[model samples]
Target: MERLCFGIDIGGTSVKLGLFTENGNLLDKWEIPTRREDSGSHILEDVAATVKKKIADDNLVRENIIGIGIGVPGPVTEDGTVINCVNLGWGIFNVSEETEKLTGFKTRVGNDANVAALGEMWQGGGRGYKNLIMVTLGTGVGGGVILNGEILTGSNGAAGEIGHITVNPSEEDKCNCGRPGCLEQFASATGIVKEAKRLLDKSKEPSKLREIQHLSAKAIFDCAKEGDALANELVEELCRYLALALSHIAHVVDPEAFVIGGGVSKAGTMLTDLTKKFYENNVLFALKNKDFKLAELGNDAGIYGSAKLIIGK
Candidate 1:
C-alpha cells in the first residue's frame, strides 16, 4: 500500500488541503472557507471534521496517512506557534497542538510563504536546485530561501523575509509593517497598481488603463502589450525595483536560482524577461549567471509543501 500524508494551507479567506503520496504525487485536493472570524479552535474543529470525512468518503485507511502538515499565512515560531496573522485575526495560535489533539494525528505547521517555497523546492520550480530563492508577488511580496538543500529558517524562523528588505530606503511610502521602502512597496501587485495609478494620475499618455477608473495589474499588462508607454514604464520600474532587491538577496544568499511565484508570475516571460534584465544590470558580477524562473506549482505550492513536510522529502 502506498503511504500518504495530508497537507493544508490556511489563508484568511479559504483553506486548501491536499492528499499526497510519499513520492510527491498529489492524489486529491479541496478548498474550504476559512471563516476566521470564528474562534481559532473552532476553525481547527472544522478542519479536523472535514479531513476525517474526506478520508472516510475516499475509503482511505489511517495507516496510509503518516501525519498532517499545515501552512499558515503568518509568522509562526520554529515550533509551530503562530505569533499573529493580521489578515486572519488570529493571535498567538498553538495551531499544530490544537490540530494534533483534535484529529489525533501528528501535525507540523510553518509559515505559508516558507512552506510554499519548500513545496517548489521539493517538487516544483526549485526542484533539483539546492540553493534557491522563491519570491512570491501577490497583493504583497513574500520570500523564501533554501540553502544546502534545506529550508533556511533562522534561529527565530524568520530568515527568508526578502520582501521586507529595503529596495528604496529613502522612499517616504510607509509599509504595512511600519517600515518605509520595503521591496513589497515596489514589487508587489499592489505596488504595481499603485505605481500605475500614480502614472495615470500624472500622465496624459493614451492608455486603456484610463478606460476603467479602477484598473488591475492584468489590465495594465494588457495595455502595455497594446503599446501603452505608461504601462510599460510602470512595469519596467517595478521590475527595476525587484531587480535591485534581488541583487541584495544575491549578495547575501548567493542562491543558484530564483523562482518567481504568486499571481503576478502569470505575466510569464514578460515579467521574467524584465526581471532577468534588471537583475543582470543590478546584481553583483559574480552572481550574474543565476537563473530566474517562474514557479511551476502556482497556488497549490503551499499544500504541496505541507504534504512534503509530513512525508520527509
Candidate 2:
C-alpha cells in the first residue's frame, strides 16, 4: 500500500527532509546544507538526489511511497509554480513539475509559511481544528490560514499574508515589503527590538533595554516578566498590534483557533495571553472565544506540513 511520503523544506541555509507515514507520523528526518552558489539552480537537483539516495539506503519500495511534498519561501500557485523566491535565488518556474521529473514521483509544493500552518493543523497545535490561522512571529511576520481543513491559497497564492496588513498608515518608515506601517513592523521579533531601540534612542526613559548591549525580543519579554515598566509597555504595544491583526483576520475567516509560532513565541503564555487579551476587546463578541495555542512542532512544522501534502491529512 502507498503508505509513505517524503517531505522537504527548503531554507536559505539548509533543507529539511523527512519520511512520513500516511497517518501523519514522522518516520525519519534529516537535513542538508543548501548549495546556493549557483543561484539555486541546483537546489531541486540536489533535493532529488538526496531523496533517491535515501530510498536506496533504506531499501524502500517506490510503490509504497505515495509522493513527495515540498515547501519553499515564496508564493506558489495551485499548479506548483513559484512566482519568485529571493532567499533561494530562484525565479518563476513550475517547482512541482521539475521536482517530479527529478524524483520520478508525484510532487506538491506550497509557500513555506502556508505549509507550516498546514503542518500545525495536521498534527501539531491546530490539530482537531478544521479552521485556524498560524502566526509566525520571527524575523518577519508570516501567516497561514486554514479554512475547513484546506489552506486558503488565495488568487496567485498570496492569500495569508497577514503581516503586510496596514496598521499604522501615518508611520514614515517602510516595511521590507515596501509598505508603510505593516503589522510585521510591530509584531515580529525584529520589529519588537527595532521599536524598543527606537524608543531608547529618542526618549530618556529609564528602561533596562537602554542598558542591554544587544537588545533582543527575549530580553524585552524577560524584563517585562521582571516588572520593568518600559519593557511592559513595549510588550503591550507588540501584543496590541498582533491583536489588531487578529481581529481583522477573525472578522474575515472566523477560524476556530490561532496557532502562534516562530522564535518570538518562545515567550510562551505571556505572549499568547497578552495578545488574546487585546484581541478579545477589539473583535466582535462572537470571535472573542477562539483558542490561542502555542505551536507544538517548532521548526518541524514545515516538513510535517509537506508530508501532509502527499498523505492529504
Candidate 3:
C-alpha cells in the first residue's frame, strides 16, 4: 500500500485540509468551517470526521496512512502543547495527543506561521535554501524563521513574532498589541493605509490617493507605480521600516533569503524590488547579498508545511 498523509491548517474561520502522498504531492484538498461556538470544542471532532470520510470515500487502507499534521494559529510547544489560541478560544492542551485520540492516527502540531514558512521552504519561494525567513504582510505582519533547515520556534514559541519588534519608540499611536512604533504599524497592509490617512490628514498634498473613496495598501502601491509622488513617498516610507526590520533579522539569523507573502505582496515585483532595494541599502555588508522573493504557494503553504511536519521532509 502507498503511504499517505493528511495536513491540516486550522484557522479561526475555517480549517484547511490536504491529503498528500508521501512525496508531498497534494492529491486532494478541502475545508470545513471552524465551529468557534462552544470554545471551538467541535473543531477536532470535525477534522477527524472529515479525515475518516476522506479515507473511506477514497477507499484508502487505514494502515497505509502515516499520520496527520496540524498547524494551529497560536504558540505551540515542541511537544504540540498549544499555550493558548484566542482565535480558536483554546487554552493550553496537547493538540497532538487529542488529535491522535480522536483520529486514530499519530499527529504533530506547529504554529501556523512557522508551518507556512516550512511550506515555503519545502516547495515554494524558499525551496533550495536551508536558511530563510518568511515575512507575511497581511492585515498584520507575521514572520517565520528557518535556521539550518529547521523552524526556529524559540524557547517560548515566539521566535518569529517579528511584527511586534519596535521600530519607533516616539510614536504616539499604539499597535494592536498596545505597543508604540511596532514594525506592524508601518509595514502591514492596514499599517500602510493608516499611514496614508495620517499623511493625508497632516498635509494637503494633491495626490490620487486622496481621491479614492476607500484606500487600500494595493491602491497605494498602484498609485506609486503610476508615479504619484505622495503615494510613492508612502511606499518608500513603508519599505524603509520593513527594510530596517529585515536588516535586524538578517543580523540575527542571517538567513539566505527573505520570502515575502500575504495580501500586500500582491503588488508583485515592485514590492519585492523596492523592499529589496531598501533592505540591501540598510543591511550589513555580509547580509547585503541575501535573496528576496515572493511566496509561491499562496494560501496552501500552511497545509504543505503541515504535511512536511509529519512526513519528515
Per-candidate TM equals: 0.93, 0.97, 0.98
Q: If the candidates were sorted by their TM-score against the true structure, best first, what order would they fall in?
A: 3, 2, 1
Mind giving the per-residue lDDT tens digits that candidate 2 earns over 110-139? 999999999999999999999999999999
RMSD of 3: 1.0
Candidate 2 global TM-score? 0.97
lDDT (Cα atoms) of all candidates against the true structure: 0.86, 0.93, 0.92
Report how far off residue 232 is in candidate 1 (Å).
Answer: 1.6
Once superposed on the true structure, which residue ranges of model 3 sit more than 4 Å away at CA?
A: none
Residue 226 miss distance in model 2 (angstroms): 0.7
For each candidate, how many residue pairs have backbone atoms clashing (under 3 Å)?
A: 0, 0, 0
lDDT tens digits by residue: candidate 1, 137-188: 9989998888876677777667788888988878897998899999898888
- Scanning candidate 3 in windows of ten residues, the lowest lDDT window is 149-158
Which candidate achieves the best lDDT against the true structure? 2
Per-residue accuracy of model 3 over 28-71 as CA lDDT, tens digit each: 99999999998889999999999999988999999999999999
Model 2 C-alpha lDDT versus the unseen true structure: 0.93
**Pairs of residues at least 3 apart in sequence or in different chains that clash in candidate 3:** none
